[model samples]
Target: MPGLQTQSIHAGRSIDPSTGAVVPPLHTSTTFERDPDGEFSRRYAYIRAATPNRDSLEACITALEGGDETISFGSGMAASFGVFQALAPKDHVLLHRDVYYGVRELMEGFFAKWGLNHTLVDMRDIDEVRRASRPETKLFWVETPTNPLIEVVDIRAVAEAARAACALLVCENTFATPVLQRPFELGADIVVHSLTKYLGGHSDAMGGSVTLKNKPELVAQIRDFQHTGGAILSPFDCWLILRGVETLVPRVRLHCENARLIAEFLSTHKGVSKVRYPGLVNDPGHAVAKTQMKDFGGMLSFEIRGGRAEAFAFTAALKTIARATSLGGTHSLIEHRASIEGKTTRAPESLLRLSVGLEDANDLIHDLDQALGSII
Candidate 1:
């Protein structure tokens, strides 16, 4: 009610009714209590219909994005699928070439089976985006500061094009959390997230969400699908993610601070070829990022001197950072983009994506230096 920052901890939740606990309790019941007299019914009657924890989490995200409604799913991919289904079978989807790999896999597999046509375009170039559009282009999917490579796209420009074409613009707002950016404010129709990441800052839970900007009917449609499809997030995971959202602002501040240091270190290192981070003054997307995002996010990517072998070694040798995938957590992670991409030319062979954590800036820098020492 006060602001996004305050609501992150208190928006959809109040004191516990039964136990008077500060934090909300996880409701594990398959069904909720109904009015015995049948005079009135509670807000939700079943887990699929609704849950207090799920509603609370949704309210927090909706308030953060200034959205009208929010929906939860088993994972980020489920949320994406809901959007995919919301579109007609023949509708076209245009996405940034460098978005989440899972999305590419879905586009090539599941969505293709449904007769949906899509394209991967360099959205930073408005002309390229304009040229990629057909009269059938019904959805423009964007992942700014994109996965692995960290390519920044123009949200407002793409939104404008979608508006003119009477299409919907959906943005994966995982990297730039609501603390850093709000895509709906820039004209996004739907804002999606992998709550398993930043929103659940600890690496303990897996979930996803979608907040709607203006489509109440679409919200009902997705709710019906989610109810029938039953890819709903569990009570425990939703509660964990809700608790995780509480520290989002402070955690993001540290993540950006640590990442800025790592980006600076990597930029000047002899072993690194190119550093990709919006925080860098000379980064290709710095100006646009500065205009859109409140601050440069914690994720950055850089190319090592050699190819795959050297990149793997660099990641494996990191003492402080973990070698894994999926970003925006409390522990720093270093991943070889080539291995995860399954041999896609989209990611450079020598590239390493860094997910900076809330560690001491100096310790992270030293760990990176020592790791690079093995290959430089």
Candidate 2:
């Protein structure tokens, strides 16, 4: 197998046979021409069913994730919904307590109406996972280094429990990315990613994907949903995501480096109450993260000394970081997770999530220092 950096650049990419172009051309045509015998000459029939760009993106992602099959969706939420759509009615799902709020809303709203069941558990506890398993439990959905809180789940342990319960284990590998973690090697059946984040790198393209290992039936269902359900990403978006995948290696390495520096600085700062980053030896998830992940990711969260007021004040004073909702962009973003999540949010009032970017570590530290100083 090629090194990850080499795969990132060369996987699913080939010299254009027709135009002799090195870069894959964006296939903007929604419909393809048929042969004289009334047979389709190419693998693609319609943009809704398939496209060259979407195929290229899916192939690249499958290679990166080390999965046998892959599917692309219009957005991260759409990709998540595709998993539920693949399951039968009344099938149960196990979710991490601090999963991205959108997944929670999906289950509580639409999935509930459709008779889908869910149990939210602390994924760090394998015992809790075992206790929560029901005969009908068809899926174990885990988000390690969970959104906002940065709590890392032991993927191998959770996979063991999921396997024992005869359930499909799916790891949302968005935060860790394939560069940091490969869930399949840890025994997960599926890997999900919000390509809008780190995979797209620029945060300009919006897309989602599922990479499957040893699950042909589930792959078919997801492919059906993608084909007939009408949430397929556009060719232009697919092309953009492929372009972003080219530089994923160096980008994530720097992201991890900068975040480590930022987290270390925040941990000892007087204005900070606590820092949640797996890179820190003292972090609750540090040991497990070290076991499963090649590098601690670029995201971390910390609690301000005061409550929501201080959290908001700190973000308001930042000169370099932007107050934003999304992550994995080139620019750093800070969000008060509790405010965004509202009443059901488990995040502390003082907690702030930071999406560390490809910025100078010292400059980011200085900006954070000034912001915290203003709050004091």
Q: TM-score for all predictions?
A: 0.97, 0.99
Instruction: Sum up the clashes in candidate 2.
Output: 0
Please write out the lDDT profile of model 1 over residues 73-161, one tens digit for every residue: 99999988878887778889999999898898888889998999999998898888888899999999999989978989889999998
Worst ten in a row by lDDT for model 2: 36-45
Top lDDT hit: 2
For candidate 2, lDDT tens digit of each residue in 187-285? Answer: 999999999999998979999999999889889999999999988999999999989999999999999999999999999999999999999999999
RMSD of 1: 1.3
- Which predicted model would earn the best TM-score? 2
Q: Which stretches of model 2 miss by more than 4 angstroms?
A: none
| Candidate 2 collision pairs | none
